[model samples]
Target: MKLIVGNKNYSSWSLRAWLALSLTGTSFEEELLPLDTPEFYERIKLLSPAGRVPVLIDGDLAVWDTLAIIEYLAERFPDAGLWPADPHARAHARSICAEFHSGFPDLRGQFPMNLRREPAPHPKGATADRDTARVREIWTTCRSRAGDGGPFLFGAFSAADCFYAPVVTRFLTYCLDMSETERAYAEAVMAHPLMQAWCADAAKETAVVDADEV
Candidate 1:
């Protein structure tokens, strides 16, 4: 299996799929394409019609979109524990992942993921403030429901964590105000071995996407 991604510091979707694939404990090749470059376009055009990063290539099949790639990985590695085992918990996880996939435009637009950027709080507009509040609510609710399962959203490091992993980085990167529970969850995500590895790579990246430097 192979996973194609974008610049680690700026590509939140790429981070999501990368984390999911890495957790499977499967040996896979990684290809990083610098975003917004002609080379990225040239190479990605040959890989997927979506012309996006985080495309998973498994033999003859290629899965585009982060959520789709995650689903593929879960099915491909059943024992990886990508989703919560309980049916109800699994559905809740999927619901939030879907919300994350389709929602949060203001927060996303205002606070693009930039791991290399120094941590500082950015002034939030009304929309962004509302979005951030929603994020905090989601995290608090998830953790409350977790009931000592573990530090992650679902008690274990599942796809829901992967979906929100980038958001965790965003919250910490912007120094957004978070409650104790939210802060704890964010810390646990940052402490994950794979997340640390990804951040180390991000710190070493020389490529700069000016648009994402918010």
Candidate 2:
């Protein structure tokens, strides 16, 4: 299996799939493309049907989209426990992952993930504020329901945690105001072994996207 992703420092979607793969302990080759570059477009055009990062190639099959990639990984490696074993927990995990994939466009656009950037206050805007509130609510609900297993949303760092890892990065980067529970969750995510590895790799990457540098 092989996973193609964008620059580690800037591609949030790519981070999701990458984290999922890592959590599964799946051995796979990685290819990183610099987003928005001519070379990147050319490479992705031939590599992925959607011309996007986080594309997974397993033998003859190619899967695009972060959620799809994660699903494929889970199905291929059932022992990974990518989703919860309990049916209800699995359903809830899928719902949250789907929500992360499709919802919160305003927060995504306004507070793009840039791991290498220093923390700063969020800019003022009703849309950003509303999105922030929604994110906080989601985090709070997930953690509250997670029981005492740990600080992860699902208590064991499943797909939902992988999906939201980048959002955690965004929150840290922009220094978004978060409740005590949200802050603890963020800290747990940042301190996860896989997350630590990802951050270390990202810190070493030299590719800089100017727009995300702020």
Candidate 3:
């Protein structure tokens, strides 16, 4: 598997796909493409017509889009349990992933993940606050589902957790308010070995996206 991504410090979508691959315990090659570069459009054109980062190349097959890549991997590696074991839990996880994937443009625009940066004041506004609240509500509900066995949503660090990994990073980066449970959950996600590796790589990246530099 060759996972193509963008600047680790700036690309939230890339991070999601990367995390899903990591969870499979499969060793794969990585291609880091700096965002907004001439080389990107030219190089990605052959890999994915969408010209997007987070494209997974598996031999002759190429999967684009973060969610699609994850789904493909899950089907390819069913034993890895990319999703939950229970059908209900799995459905909930997928629903949450969908929500995270497409429903919070405002929060996403306001809180770009910057792993290299420490917590700081976030922008304030109605949309921002509403997004934050919705995220917290989702976290609360998911944690309730996790019960006590695991710290991740639906437990066991499934695709749902992968989908939200960037959100956790964003919360910490912006120093956004989180409840005790929410903070614990976020901290747990950060402490995961794979997440630590991602953050370490992100720290080593010198590239910057000006628009994401808030």
Candidate 4:
């Protein structure tokens, strides 16, 4: 399998797909395209019609969107435990992932994922504030449901973790307020080996996206 991703310093969606793929314990080749560049546009066009990063290619099949890539990986590698085994837990996980996929515009627009940014509080808006509170609520709810299973959202580092991993980075990068529970969950995601590896690689990149630099 070959995965095409964008600049690690700013591509949150790419991180989602990459993390899920990594959890599969599958050998795959990765290609990083510097975002917001002519090269990225030219190269990504051939990979997917969406012209987005995080395209996973397995054999002759190409999965474009982040959620689609994750679903494909989960189906292909059932033993990876990408999603929860319990039907109820799996549905809950998918619900949050879908919410994250289509919602949270305020938080996302105000705080773009930038691993290279120094940790500090950035100014926020009302809707962004509400978004943060909603995220905390989601975390608290997940913890209550899966507290005994493990430290992760659904416990055992499933697709739910991958979906919110970038939000964890956003919280830390912008020094957003987090409760003890939320902080602990964020810490657990950051402490994962794959996430650490991704961060290390992100730190080594020299490319810059001017829009996300703020």
For model 1, residues 24-98, the per-residue Cα lDDT tens digits are 999999999999999999999999999999899999999999989999999989999999999999999999999
Candidate 3 on 61-165: residue-level lDDT in tens? 999999899999999999989999899988999999998887898888878788888778866778888999999999999998788779888778889989888
Colliding pairs, model 4? none
Q: By summed lDDT, which 10 consecutive residues of candidate 3 come out lowest?
A: 117-126
Give lDDT for model 3.
Answer: 0.89
Better of 3 and 4 by TM-score: 4
lDDT of 4 at 104: 98
* TM-score: model 4 vs. ground truth: 0.98
Can you tell me which runs of candidate 2 are displaced by over 4 Å? none
**What overall lDDT, based on C-alpha atoms, would model 2 receive against the true structure?**
0.88
RMSD of each: 0.7, 1.2, 0.9, 0.7
Instruction: In model 4, state the lDDT of residue 12.
Output: 96
Task: Tell me the tens digit of each residue's lDDT in model 4 across 32-102.
Answer: 99999999999999999999999999989899998899999999999999999999999999999999999
TM-score of each: 0.99, 0.96, 0.97, 0.98
Clashes of each: 0, 0, 0, 0
Local distance difference test values of all predictions, in order: 0.94, 0.88, 0.89, 0.94
Report the C-alpha lDDT of model 2 over 1-214, residue by residue, as the tens digit.
Answer: 8989999889988889998888888698999999889999999999887989989999999999998999999998899989988899899889988877888888887888888887888684788788888778889999998998878988889999998889998888898888899999999999999889888989998887876764
Instruction: Provide the lowest-lDDT 10-residue window in model 2.
Output: 205-214
Q: How many clashes show up in model 1?
A: 0
